[model samples]
Target: MMRHLRSIMRITWVDKVPSKEVLERTGLPSMEDLLTRKNLRWTGHLMRMSPNRLPNKSIYSQMPSVHRKRGRPRLRFKDTIKRNQKLRDIKTHSLASLSQQRDKWREIVK
Candidate 1:
């Protein structure tokens, strides 16, 4: 989308697009905004789950599945989030409460 928007900007402005300038400078909403919004929404979804709802809860926990024969076990949500994010705690109970604060969780996800 950034590339396409840059292309259109260049064409419409007769080939004078700013180099490495932000989308906001052009008065446009940005991909980063969209992604962060989506992440916040997903974080909210995870935070609002109950253990009885297996799928959402299972995202931060291991699930039973067929084993692979090779390099490593398949990646799951818990593995990815834990590797990239730092938190005071990642246990299921704490995750739910911490994620209740939208801005805080957004920063962690980002």
Candidate 2:
């Protein structure tokens, strides 16, 4: 994407233009920011789902005990959500109540 953007603007790496400047010039959000926003939006959708729904239930489900491989444990969906929230400096404690209010959550996401 950076390469594409640079090409569109006729910028070469030799020009030593920073990627941040390129993104700003193109009026686009950084890839990380875009992903974080999507994650937050999905989390809000899950939070607003009916408790009996499968997607919502899966979020709160506990994994059963099992044998582990000789490597670092994989990150769960819950962990990813927490990481995204942390990146945005959002308070988890208030997320439940805040997410229920669509307008407020939309503002925060922006």
Candidate 3:
């Protein structure tokens, strides 16, 4: 992504332009930040859904007790959301309440 940005700006590595300067010059955010914001926004949407809805249930549902042979458990969507929330310094306990307010949630996610 940085490569594409640099190309668009007609910059080369030889110019020694830092990625941060490129992003600032283009008035854009980093790819990771964009993804994190999108995920958190979607999570807020899910939080506003009815509890019985499939998407909402899937996120808050309890998993059955079953042992796995895995050395590391696969990351789930919920885990990803939690990580994103932490990155943004959002409190987990307030997620549901905050998300219920669409305008507020949008501001917080940004």
Candidate 4:
């Protein structure tokens, strides 16, 4: 989306400023920011859910051992959470602690 937005700007003779600058000027959050917020929101939702509410706990907590046909395996959603946690430097392991604290989680997500 960022690339496409930049191309649109270029075609409009507005390439002098960076894509981020244009997005800011238009009061829109970048794609990355939107994805990050969504990821965090989903995490919060999952954390609040009971074992019965979640379709299958194994999806997030376990990976079946199997050999791939042959190619780079895609990163899983669980891996993405870990990567985001590391990137954000979240120390708490039990993110569920914030299930009842909306403001705190929002701050952490940001």
lDDT of 3 by residue, 20-81 (tens): 99999999998898999899889988988998999988888888989888689989998999
Model 1, 1-110: lDDT tens digits are 66676776664445565544647556765565555456545656766677578767566465477767988777665554553333324455566676877677766555
- Please report the TM-score between candidate 3 and the true structure: 0.87
1-110, model 2: which lDDT tens digit per residue? 99999999999999999999999999999999888899899999999999999999999999899998999999999999999888877799999898999999998787
Question: Could you tell me which 10 consecutive residues in candidate 3 have the lowest summed lDDT?
Answer: 61-70
Which residue ranges in model 3 land beyond 4 Å of their true spot? none
Once superposed on the true structure, which residue ranges of model 1 sit more than 4 Å away at CA? Answer: 11-37, 64-66, 87-94, 102-110
Candidate with best lDDT: 2
Superposed Cα deviation of residue 54, candidate 4 (Å): 2.9
Report the Cα RMSD per candidate: 5.3, 1.1, 1.6, 3.4
lDDT of 4 by residue, 37-93 (tens): 788778777776776665438545665687877788898887777777776676555
Clash counts for all predictions:
0, 0, 0, 0
Residue 75 in candidate 3, Cα distance off native in Å: 1.0
| Alpha carbon lDDT of each predicted model | 0.59, 0.92, 0.90, 0.72
